[model samples]
Target: MGEGVTVSGDIAASSDIRIDMWSKLGSRVEVGGNAYLGEFVTIDGKLLVEGDLDVGKEVKIRGGFEAKGWIVVRNPVPVIIFLFLYIREMMRLGKGEEIEKAVEELFEDSEDSQDFEGKEPSENIMIIPAGAKISPEVIEVAGEADIGSNCLLIGNIRAQTVETGKNLTLKGSVYSEGKIIIGESSTVHGNLFSKGQVHIGRNSRIFGGIKADSVLMHENARVDGTIKAPSGVSFLREAAEKQILVEVNALGKGIVSKARELPKGVLQDDLIKAPDVAEIVSLIKSSAKAKNGFVPGRKRKTARTQALERTRRFTGARTYRKEKSGD
Candidate 1:
C-alpha cells in the first residue's frame, strides 16, 4: 500500500509486499513476489526479494540487498556519472561514432574492475615527480594540483587549485579558477590568472602579467609585468627597489591612485600613465554593439532615434520658456 511500515522482525511474504510512496521500513524486509519501493524510503536492515525489486527516488539501504529477479532503479543519475556521459557524448559528436565505440571498447573492462588495470586512470590530483619532464601543451586536472620541486611542466595548467613546489619551472601560463600558490624560487614564464586568491612565495618570479581577485606577494618576489586585482594586493615585506606595475586602486587601508603623487619613500617607481581616451571610447562602442546585438544599418536608425528624442526635448523646453514669458 501507499503507506509507511515499521517492522521489528523479518517479514516473509508468500505473495508480495509492496512498499510505496514515502514509506519507510525500520528492520529487515523480505518479499517472495515483487517488491516495489517509492520515493524517500529507507530500509535499515537487509532487503531480499525473490521475484523482482523496483526502487524510486532517494532510496537508502543501510545493510545489503539480494534480488533473484530483475532490479530497477528510477532516479536522476549521480553528477559523476553525468560528467562521464557528457564527455562521451561530446567525443561522439566531435569524432565519429566508430571512434567512440573503439574508445569504449578500450576501457570497457574497467567498468567492473575496482582497481585501475590497463585502464586510463582518471585522477583529481596530478603530482609531477621531481626531475620529471612533461611537455604537454595543456594539463587539465579536475582537483588540486601539485608540481614537485625541480620538475619542469612545460605547458599551460588548468586546474581547480594549484600548488607548486620550490624550484619548479613552468613554461606556459597558469589559469586556475581557485587559489594558486607559488612555491619559493619557482618561475612561471607566462601569464597567471586566478579567479580566487593568489599567493606568491618568496624569491619567486613571474615574467608575465597577473590577474586575480586578490594577490599576496612575499618579499623579493619579482613580477615583470602588470599586476591587477579587483579586491586588492598586499605585500608581506617590502623589497628594496622593487619595480613592478601595480594597478593600485586601493593600497593597504588607504586608497591611492596613479593620478595623485605616491608617498615619497614608500614606493620607488613612477608607473602612472593617463588613460587613453580614444581607446576607451572604442572599447565602449564595441561593448554597446555586443550588448545590443547591433547590425550595421540598424545602428544608424537607433542613433537617429536618440538624436530626434534629444531634439524634441530641447524644443519642448524652449517652448515652455516662451509660454512662461508670455504669461
Candidate 2:
C-alpha cells in the first residue's frame, strides 16, 4: 500500500505484506509470512505475524501484537544495496547463475504473464500524502515526525523521534522513543517524554513536566511542571539553541531525503571476503525445520481443518500446509 492510505477492515496476507509510509489500518492485521511496515504506519487493532516483522520508526500497533517469529525494528536497506550484497554472496557460493536467472525473471516478460502486459499497479495500490490529515484523531507514527512552526495539533504524538518547529501549538503530549527537539516559542499543553534525549528551544513553554534520558533547555524556556532527566539537565544560550535547531533540522531533512541504506560494503581493494568451503558443506548438511500444519495467529476451532502434504522427488522430504475450511 502507498502512503496515507487507510483500510477500514482486517487484512490477511498469504505471504509478505509491505506497506509504504503513513498508512493506517483500522482493524486487525494478519500476515502469513513476513511484514515490512514503513514509517508512521498504524494498525489500530491486533497484529499477528507468522514470519519476521521488520518495521521502521514511529510505528504504532495500538491494540496488541503477537509474532511467532522475530520482531525487529529498523530502517531497511535500499533495494540497490540489497541486490548488490545478494549478488556478491551468491557469487562467493558459486551460484552466480541463479541470481542472474532471478534478475531475468523480474525484467523479462513471459508468455504466462502476457494477459497482464498493459495493466498498471494502480488498481492494487493506494497513495496518501505525507503531512495530510485524513482523520481527526491523533496521529501515531513509526518514524521521526516533524511539526512545522506555528502549527496547532491535538492529541498525543508518538514517534521514534520528534521535532516541533518554532512557534508551534499542541494540546497533547509528545512521546518519543528516541530524541525530541521542541522548537522555539512553542507551547505545549501536555507533557514531553523521550527515551533518549530532549532539547527544549528558546522562549518555549510547556504546561506539563518533561521526562527523558537527558534534557537540554534554552535559558528562556519555561516548564510549569517538574523536570526529570536521569542523565542530567543543561541550559544553553538562545544562540546555542538556535544552532542546535538548525543542525537538527538539517539532519532530519537529510535522513528523509537521502537513501542511507545500511550494511555498507567493506572494501579491501574492492574485494569481498571469500566464503569458506567447510562452511558451505556444513550448511548443506544442516537440518531443515519440520513443516507441520502451523499457521500464524489464532486458529479457528469453528472451521474445519485439513493437513495437505507433498513429498519431494529427490530428498523424500514432505511439505505441508493447512487447507482452508469449507473448500
Candidate 3:
C-alpha cells in the first residue's frame, strides 16, 4: 500500500505486503510472502512473515517479529519513487509496452484475487471507482462499502454495510451487519444477508435470495430466490415521497408504521436530507391537497414545452381538416 495507510487490526496478505513510510500499523501483521516496510514505520503488535523481511530506518515492531526467510534492515525505497525509476529505465531502453503491461497487471488485481478472502476486517474500506479495471475477488471490509455506478465487481462483499449506485454489475453476494441499499438498475448475482433492513431500488435484479430484518423493494425489482424478513416486506412502486404519501393516506385511522420510526441519522445522506415523517403525518392529519390542475407527486413541465405540445395538436387537426376538404 502507498503512504498514509491507517491500518487497524491484523493484516494478512497471501503475497507481498509492502507499506510505505511514516505509516502506523496498529496491530499484528502476517504475510505469506515478502514484507517490505518503509522508513519510520511503527507496528504496535507482533509481525509474522513467511518470507523475506525488508525494513527501512526506525521501523519499530514493538511486539517483535518472526520470519522464516532473510531479514534486511536498510533504507527501503518508497513505492512511488521505485516506480518512477523503473519507468525511467524502461524509457531509456526505448520500451513502452512493458510499462502498460505492468499497469494492466496492477489494475486487474490478479494478485488480489488470491487467498485474501476471509482475512480479518482491515478497519478500512476498498472503494472501486466507476470504470476501474478490477478482477473478481471476494473482499471483506470493516466499514461501509459505497460502490460507484456502472462498475462491475466480480466478488462477494462482506462489510458493516453496503450501498451501491445505479447500473452496477456485481457477481457476488453481499453480507452486512447493517442496512443494504442498492441503487436502481443494478444486478447482483448472489444472495444478500443483512442484520438490518434491505432496500432494493427500481428495476434491479438479484439472482439470489435476500434475508434481513426488513425488506423494502421496488415494484419492478426481481429476486430469483426467496426473500425472508421477520419485520416484513414493503413495495414502493413510486417515488419515496409519493410512497410516503400513499402510506399516510392509507392510514385513515392515523396509524404510523413502526418501520418509519427509525432513529434520526440512521438513514442520513450528505446531499439529501432524511424525510421528516412526523411532518408528513401532520400534513396527512391536516388533509393537505393541491388545487386546480396541479397534481401531487408529478414533476411540473415547462411552460414552453406545454405550449409546443398544444400547438402540435392544433396543427394536426388543421392538417386533417384541409386534407378532408381537398378530397
TM-score for each model: 0.34, 0.37, 0.38
Model 1: how far is 38 from its true place, Å?
39
**Tens-place lDDT digits, model 3, residues 1-327:** 545455555677776788877777888899988898988889999999999999999999999999999999985357678888999999899889998899787669565454444553332224332212222456566666777677777778877889988998989999899999999999999999999999999999999999999999999999999999999999997654322321334444334555655455544332233344453333322223543454556657788997999999999999999999999
Better of 1 and 2 by TM-score: 2
* Reference-based lDDT, residue 191, model 1: 89
Candidate ranking under TM-score, highest first, comes to 3, 2, 1
**Candidate 3 segments exceeding 4 Å error:** 1-137, 239-327
Q: Which residue runs of candidate 2 sit more than 4 Å off their true CA positions?
A: 1-137, 238-327
Q: Report the error of model 3 at residue 311, Å.
A: 72
Badly placed stretches (over 4 Å) of model 1 are 1-135, 238-327
lDDT by residue for model 1 over 205-317, one digit each (tens)?
99999999999999789999999999999988854454333343322232335565456675543544434323112222334355554544444457788899999999999
> For every candidate structure, what is the RMSD over all alpha carbons to the true structure, in angstroms?
26.1, 36.3, 22.0
Per-residue CA lDDT of candidate 2, range 1-327, in tens?
657767665678876678878888888899988898998899999999999999998999999899888889885558668888888999999997899898997678463344322554333222333443323455576676766666877778877898877888988898889999999999999999899999999999999999999999999999999999999999996432111111123223311224423335633334322233121122222223424444345343432332222223323332223233324
lDDT, residue 139, model 2: 54
Give me the candidate number with maximum lDDT.
3
For candidate 1, the lDDT comes to: 0.72
Report model 1's TM-score to 2 decimal places. 0.34
Residue 253's lDDT in candidate 1: 31
